[model samples]
Target: MRRIWFALFGGLFGAVGVAFLGAFRADALADPTSLATFSLWLGASTLYVLGGLDASIGDFDWYQLVGLGNVCLGLQMVARAAMTLADGTGETEPLLATFGGVVGGLTLAYIGLDWFRGGRHFDLSTFEESPTADPE
Candidate 1:
């Protein structure tokens, strides 16, 4: 079930990554970076978030990883937003829409994956700590 969720959402993120990366060469997006490096950075970060979410459930919890990923992606979007637009950048509204689209998709996937995985708890604080065996 987890694998299935990963395969589904991972592909979604990957597609969004490609769209954002391709926005540079295409007219579909505004705020296209003049440098290929930025495109790659955004694409790579998107994929990172995707891959991080797709990582198999280890001893550590998955939500913590995904939550941290939300932070990382949030930071990237914020930093990129801080940059002044180059002359003749495309529509700002569309750019924002595009950004929101990707983030929203990732968030939905995150929550959906959690629901599909069976159990849920507020394990945020201790996700990093090793799990202890239940004592009777």
Candidate 2:
């Protein structure tokens, strides 16, 4: 029980910290707005994966696997930010964006393959796509 609490809080805090770090790094990127966009997309994806992991109630499963992959991607972005800062306005955009695009692109490919192979659906969620919403 205590371990569950630790994992829950640890995961929550870890994700939040990573996202916050990304937010703080936005200004250092080649184009702050582009990094902002990346942060936004990554933030949404992080929240979604966290929600799934939370729903699983700390079980070790696919949700955790997805969350782990997300962590990998987030670390890369953070590393890019650090590199950009270190370079101090050198030709960092291409390298940073290329790395992000490659990793994110491959992630999307894996996700698409898994989805087509009957993987988890982010859609059909009772939380998001509630059937009882008032027709507006």
Candidate 3:
């Protein structure tokens, strides 16, 4: 069951990556957005594969994979922001994108680092009840 879920997740990311790559190829020099999208999706696909392996084999550190994903996502966002600014449309949306991209990227990168250091902010085990807990 877990394997199936992981396969589906990885496949989804891989498909998106392929689509973005195709889009980029169709007009390689004109669109930077597609390139960034391809990169992030590729990273996501790789992360899921590594994560699945760690789940099954018990040697790999899944948190590190997650951290890598976060960093990739952050970089992608920053790239998008730069592309948007490069357009020079003189619009407010570009400013918003820039602000959001930088802040979100930094925040996610920090969270990723915390997870890499064994932080439990999103650890599922923390939600499990203790074996000795009294039945309510």
After superposition on all CA atoms, what RMSD does each candidate show versus the true structure? 9.2, 12.6, 4.6
For each candidate, the alpha-carbon lDDT, in order, equals: 0.48, 0.49, 0.64
How many Å off is the CA of 40 in candidate 1? Answer: 9.6
The superposed Cα distance between candidate 3 and the true structure at residue 113, in angstroms, equals 1.6
For each candidate, how many residue pairs have backbone atoms clashing (under 3 Å)? Answer: 0, 0, 0
Give lDDT: candidate 1, residue 24. Answer: 56
- Candidate 3 error regions (>4 Å): 1-10, 24-37, 55-60, 120-136
Judge candidate 2 against the unseen true structure and give its global Cα lDDT, from 0 to 1: 0.49
- Candidate number of the best lDDT: 3
- Best first by lDDT, ranked: 3, 2, 1
lDDT of candidate 3 over 1-136, digit per residue (tens):
2433444676677887677657776674356575665667578667766654555334547656655666666666766777778778887877986889888977876766666567657563442235675878
Model 2 ranges off by over 4 Å: 1-30, 37-45, 48-104, 112-117, 120-136
Tens-digit lDDT track for model 1 on 1-136? 2323433554566677677657655543444443433454444454445434555545444554454444444444444444433333688885776567556646644543453342263333332335577897
Q: Give the TM-score of candidate 3.
A: 0.67
User: Which structure is stronger by lDDT: 1 or 3?
Assistant: 3
Q: Please give, for residues 93-117, the per-residue lDDT of candidate 2 as tens digits.
A: 7667756765765565455344334
Reference-based lDDT, residue 71, model 2:
48
